[model samples]
Target: MSDASAVTVAVLDDLRQESEELDLLVAGADAARWAGPTPAEGWTVAHQIAHLHWTDRVALIAVTEPDAFAAEVEKALAHPGTFVDEAAGELVALLPPGELLTRWREGRDRLRAALGAAPPGVKFPWYGPPMSVASMATARLMETWAHGQDVADALGVTRTPTARLRHVARIGVRARGYAYLVRGMQAPEEEFRVELDTPDGGTVAFGPEDAPQRVTGPLLDFCLLVTQRAHRDDLAVRAVGPDADRWLDIAQAFAGPAGPGRAPKRGAAGRGDAE
Candidate 1:
């Protein structure tokens, strides 16, 4: 395995740990709370967890049996994006909240082990292309952290980013290309110099010494803002250079076209406007 591959594994480890943290945070909530509104629009935290567990199952299936991916996506797409809009409300309405959490915990653990033990060199077919197991793992982390933040926010809790968030930061950096393309601009070929503050009150920086594009902030802040899991005003990321500034304004870690992008103003009202 190469360095890049190791990064994915590290991200997987982060997901595993974060999954446990999320489980603890959401434990023992009432059905109504489960049904309570989350920042993720229609879906509640329960729905988000279900989706994460679902992806683990689907991704593993794609790895173990590559031939079935296309057909599976057809079935998977039946639920729409993350299936929260489809099943979470129903799950919250029908099942006991405890049961739902129990199911999600079991599913999350199973998927964790499955990915860890996934057959080597497997490239799970995704919307983009067949991604190596490592990429799949990173995707899992990104999803877990992004969605978990939703739950944390709903509960008025602050979830800090671990050192492992370097992976998420990296994805946000690379996805600048996608952001640019979505806006009908040629993808910038220049690399980004990313800097994130760590959980231990330290800063993490990446890329070349003189990289023109740079992202600097706390890892949690950067991860949350870039994933669109949270608004930019919540974080204090400083981006320099014209291209870097625009990309940061719209950097999306997920696979998709750019939606409306908001530049973080120094002072805006509300929690989202916090600098």
Candidate 2:
């Protein structure tokens, strides 16, 4: 049995730290800042945070009522197109600032324990198939890194992806096929290598060495852009060759509709690779 405890622990800690960081980033910003629009359509900083909180609420239900819980998510998404905005507003206001922070911390702690104790074979109906607790924890970490990008951008704060976020990047790289299929593209042939810049300016390379396609850049930037949190235009990531470039274009870090992704824009300056 793959014990997911290690990752569960890491994920929980990352969430706690970033949540605390977000509190710091948004603390001085005005309410308008919190309510500021993010790249996510119909989502603001508050809405993204609310989405995290709301997800925590639903994810808690995963251990037992996974199916029903996911269905509720579907129902929520299925609401009339315009309702997304209205629903986001309602959810964003669901918690008072302090209470939300408290719950966010407490809930993630509980989440660690839950994931650590989860049976490897327990299946989540909506997510489909039984997942080991490792997969479950990784999934959450993926969510945190992606959404945290939303908060970081709204504040114009450049967030360097931490070493631990590699787990998140790995998840994104592994999702390549799904990304292609999602975009109605033929999953490419030709093996590829992902050469990513670590949060500390080191490199972690994945895939076969001989692979012609290589993705190289700050790991955090790649993850953020891939997951649709930070715009590709906002980060310094390079896709060598045509196949690699294509992946960057339609990379969908989350499991939803193909989002609006564009070419690299004039990204603001940030800490360069320490190396």
Candidate 3:
């Protein structure tokens, strides 16, 4: 296989693994469990899965039917804030837990197939911007992991951190500028160095070593912070310099308006050990 193709396959495999992990969590859930409230205010466990199903279906359209995807974009533009929630709510109301689970599984399988078959160098249109197939897979994985966190939290489950988080962390790092842009702020001109302690006790570093701004912390904490799944204050992430500190406060890996990030846990200390 070509170098790029190999990379794509790896990402897609990771995406599948991430989705399957989440599936295992909810596959046997009873209706009461599916209706349990999650951290994403007003969204239940069922809503989280429905949202993933809705997004994957739309993403498949973007990959295989560009013109049709434009209509989806138009719908999003018309509603902006409520469109996502509305779709998820409709799915939840229309389908019972069992049907929802089956549909979500089918949608994910179709999306994986479509993305895998996409031509190299082709970019698929999205709500934010076009994305390459590999990037699309990574974004899906990040969302799955983030939403899965909510499910895990509701179910009182603790998932072991894994290397798959590297994909989510990478997206978190890459979306630094988008985080700023969405908030009507310009990103710092200078690159920032980020060093995350991986689950295996190694490090995954990004950007230049000599960069003036830096963020350092556990990879899982960084991923949680960027995905807005955990409040910065509750995470171990540390930032140096004003820009990096600001980035941590506003960082979001998902494409959308700035999310109302999770509130600091009751009695939790303030923003990580930033200097």
Span of 10 residues, lowest total lDDT, candidate 1: 266-275
Q: What is the lDDT of candidate 3?
A: 0.93
Residue 3 in model 2: lDDT: 39
Clash number by candidate, in order: 1, 1, 0
For each candidate, what is the lDDT? Answer: 0.69, 0.67, 0.93
TM-score of 3: 0.98
State the weakest 10-residue window (summed lDDT) of model 3: 266-275
lDDT of 2 by residue, 95-202 (tens): 655555566667766766776666655655433234455555666777776777777877788875566677678767877887887667798877679888775658
Put down candidate 1 lDDT per residue, 196-256, tens digits, no spaces.
7788988777778788667677787788777887567656677776666666667887764
Off by over 4 Å in 1: 1-9, 75-84, 87-95, 182-184, 257-275
Name the lDDT value of residue 66 in candidate 1. Answer: 72
- Best-matching candidate per lDDT: 3
Q: Rank order by lDDT, top first?
A: 3, 1, 2
